[model samples]
Target: MDSYKLLINLPDTIVFLSPNLKVVDATDEYLKATMKTREELIGQDFLTTFPDNPSELLSHNMMIVRDSLMRVIATKDTDLLATLRYDIPKPESQGGGFEERYWEAVHKPVVDENGNLKYIIQRTSDVTQNVLAKRAAELEENKYRFMMNALPQLIYTTDNTGRATFFNQKWYDYTGTNPDILATNSWQSSIHPEDLPKVIEKVGHSLRNGTEFQMELRVRNGKGIYRWFLTRSIPMRDENNNILMWVGSSVDVHNTREMVFELEQSHEQMVELSEQVQQAYGKAEAERKVLHNLIMKAPVFFCVLRGPEHRYELMNERYQKLFPNRNLIGQSVAEALPEVAEQGFVKVLDEVYETGREFVAEKIKVTLDRYGNGKLEEMTLTFMYQTIYDENSKVTGIMVCGFDVGEQISS
Candidate 1:
């Protein structure tokens, strides 16, 4: 009896029989379910066990047990047999079907007759939980559809070939056409003819390559006005990376187009301001040249020396009188004058180049042959030579231009 392990204390109902189809034993489960007792079932015949067929479940479900056991023995199959079925009782008052509690029954062969099967066993488990879960999932899908329908933006979809699959109610409400009308094309019957080709081309590319789609096109609104819309789409792909469909949306962009036109108007104003700035620059250039000429002729012994190259770029009238007809431009220290080399000017050049030092000789003792060539240890001159730099901040050259305006001190 324990080998009838499943029958020991089943929560629902169970019955065990012998090879002669006699009720050799019965479970407390079966007795309680049928409103009978163990003694009433012990020696009863199988046909008389459930005398009323207990709602005819015997003849209806006995074939399921016999067929499943035969199918297993015949082919040695292991897949779940489709013989399992549901049974739920209902009165006419309950509308001819059970409210919700679904049941699943299982049957198996328990005994074999002289080299063939004799006794078969059965068990049923409640399936209300599974049925309820499926019902809830369906309700959730409908709820999602309702939310999508409430959106103000026009929603649409297409298959992998860019053929329309879905267009929401809002789209139909705006276009004044049935939702089914656009199955063959997305913007065909709806878009302005001038924008149709480009919209179709972009949508086709996105569908074929599973890419995101975006384009501007004109759509006819409910009022029959052709307005611009920015349509965008994203590809929906399956688990295997194959394109399943394309999901998309469109928004009215007429207001944004007007804003863009205003921005262009502002751009034209900026162009006119740029022309005025250019005219101001030309006037500034003319004044700058006049000032430069004045700086070259002022009564001062000053010149713009070209760094340590010792070349004179711009010299004043005083400096010009001091060195007459001397073209010192493009001349290095050694090539400028023999006197420039005779002095320690070359040493200063090499020192500044190696050490990046600023040399400013505000006062120095020197012999100038403008009066006469006489070497003096301290013929005082007010000279100033300092470093000058270009835009790159490099110490490119030294400015060595100043006047000698001093007399020697009496020793």
Candidate 2:
């Protein structure tokens, strides 16, 4: 067999260059891949024949290729270049533009008996698809991280063995701890002593059984004040339903729990004093007023929506301030806040109302025409919809309570 014919017919995209970096020859596969014929490539300078894409202002393809070739010459050994974006120009008949491409290349030097470099052999493979796929995956991961960090709740991830692996910024901010704490039991030390045992037992059981873990525990904040947090963790599974990891969130519910306790106490006192109609009625009314005042003065926004259409029955001062120009009371949510409905809040409301289940969402994005000028503005909220019941235990309305966390997240 002819040696030159054998080299040209080889199935790999290979090119041979002289010691002076002049193209000596290339395989047929190389000619086809580069959209050039042997007549156009042979005898031409290797760098001149395949120049960097001029349209790309920050292109470093020529520099990288030259450095790899120089390294091979210096070491007299093979040099590998991975994931290089070396675009190729199209022929004028093909509309005359550069086509974006990625490649993996190997540059090997052939030496003579005297150890002098004779020829440089280049082998390259197109890796455009793999490079693009990796970039897309990285972009998706970045988006996921952005969403996690935007949440008001503390977000974390753990291995199947219940060992913590990752925690978002909110976790560090709330705990006033650094990444070093994850390696030790320092995070657990922040949990109240009374709640630590239960948390450990529940987490261990969940890890053993691959079940969801949930608990309301008191966690000490940056100021060393213990506050109640509703913590929940769910197992992330693989295709075969095997546990891979755990994703968890801890939402601070201290104020809501305190308010509920106060309401329950007031309800019990009203029931006990019911026999004395005049005295009971006055005392119950006074208690109701005090509770109303407390709700009004709370830091979070609060509202009550009645009926299936979600007509705004009442809104606290904070809630009303969210849409100062709109008349929310006596108006359906869809009528008063069309933008909210457009963003699918009404569907979420319907689901909660129909199921009679509380829906809690943290860092939910809500767009509103705040000034009634038809200009939409986006805001982030950490909120909940709790089912309200009538005297006979029939679901009547929904109580909406939330904090506008836009400023907090931005800062």
Candidate 3:
């Protein structure tokens, strides 16, 4: 580890000067580079290697080399690395030539036991590729930030604990909150109270299951209006499926909810109004039919009774027409009509006399031998029965009406 031996035999020896500024040992590599042998250069001075002219490299005044070597010696105990640029005289093949060599050297001060300064150690490294790569990464980071801030949808990221760590500018603009609010309960405050429980349930389930998350809920805007937000979150995980982080997006659905509510309101109003109008028309039609039957007939086709024992009562032309050849005054209908018992008409009349509800039979048809030779004829009779009521709304007797409808039935 002798300095003289290392300096003379080192293959990359550009030059190695002693502390006394003397050429005590010219490196073998230096001698070999100069097209000279060691025997002729071992004890020679620095002036013997090059021309001893005043302006040449070995001259009386080498200002650049002297100043550089002086600075390296003085700064040996201070800065660890040093840089120096120098012009190396190239081979004078056809003309005088020069080249610039930039050297970045690491310098360390060597010391002796007597606390005397010794020769310094230096090492050089090239950094052409490293500097270029570092610059490229800086440019990429700026580009990414620009794109994120310009996004319309809110972009957000959270840790595995469901705590927010990062969100884009769009999220802040929509929510009117800063990054300081992210670690707090600011995000939960934005969600509507009604939708909070479902979002929590699903998010908790996905977190425990180590799966992606998705949810839809109403979120309060800056103006304090609740709007629908469709959130989709994807779990970021390690290779073993352990949760690392989550990424999600929020999209606005305010217009969609408003439109749906409007349609539902319109449908409900239509249903209620239709039912009201239908009931009103049905009642009016029923009343018109009752009034028309009373006033439209001259010699009425109906009659009523009023006193005890169902005595002989008033009759109509239609009734007298049925028994045309007989004087039908003061004659009971049950006695005159022999088929009344078989037709069940008296039973219905008795029920009406007790209940006082108007009871009517639509129609009944009988085939009678009308001709003398026993030829058959068909007749249809419609009877309406009602229990007559007095001034006190008490039942007095029954009213019955009959109509022949055999021809109307065929039509």
lDDT of each: 0.60, 0.86, 0.59
Candidate 3 per-residue C-alpha lDDT over 1-411 given as tens digits, one digit per residue, 9 for 90 to 100: 697776667765444345544444446655544444566544454333443233335323334444445676776563333433333344566255443333354444456887566754433333324544666888897787677777556778889988787888887788777887775757788789999999899889887887767667887767787778667788888999788899887766454445446544654554455565547677555344433333223232556655433434766666555445555346554544535534665566667677454554456775543332344556677666656778976788877665667644566
Candidate 3, residue 110: how far the Cα is off, in Å: 2.2
Residue-level lDDT of model 2, residues 62-169, one tens digit each, is 989999999988999999998779888788889988888889999999999999999999999988889889999999999998999997779999988888888898
| Model 2 TM-score (2 dp) | 0.72
Question: What's the C-alpha lDDT at position 195 in model 2?
Answer: 99
Writing each residue's lDDT as its tens digit, candidate 1 over 1-411 gives: 576666656676656655455676666775654445677777787554433224445324544544554564454342143423334334455565323344454445553455465554545455558777887999997887787688656888877877787788888888887855775454476899899888878776876677788777889977888877777788888999888888888776654455446545654554455565547677456445545454454333556556555566766676655545666566675665556567886677657554444344546665433322333233445543445678975666664445545522332
Choose 2 or 3, whichever is better by lDDT: 2
State the weakest 10-residue window (summed lDDT) of model 2: 269-278
Give me the candidate number with maximum TM-score: 2
C-alpha TM-scores of all predictions: 0.40, 0.72, 0.42
Count of backbone clashes for each model? Answer: 3, 0, 0
Compared with the true structure, model 1 gives a TM-score of: 0.40
